[model samples]
Target: MTWVGPSACTLPTVEQPLRVAEFDALFAGAVQGVAPPGPRN
Candidate 1:
């Protein structure tokens, strides 16, 4: 599973859909100004 070189590594097609889902979750969280619970200004 290692590309291990000076070239690009390609992810499997099966994993492409999952990438979209991951991006969607991130986008939704950002739109809501979601942040890790911590000290704030």
Candidate 2:
């Protein structure tokens, strides 16, 4: 259930939550949407 792959960011495990919080705060007002899964090629 990890949010990203090992190379996604340099933050250590303990610091990830803080980074997530920062993103959440910055994007709080962003538009929200979802798309249905597309068929596999």
The candidate scoring highest on lDDT is 2
lDDT of 2 by residue, 1-41 (tens): 65667789899989988888887776676737657899989
Residue pairs with backbone overlap in model 1: none
Model 1 CA deviation exceeding 4 Å by range: 1-9, 32-41
Q: What is the model-wide C-alpha lDDT for candidate 1? A: 0.62
The Cα local distance difference test for each model comes to 0.62, 0.78
List the candidate 2 regions with Cα displacement exceeding 4 Å: 1-3, 30-41
Least well predicted 10-residue stretch by lDDT in candidate 1: 1-10
TM-score of each: 0.46, 0.50
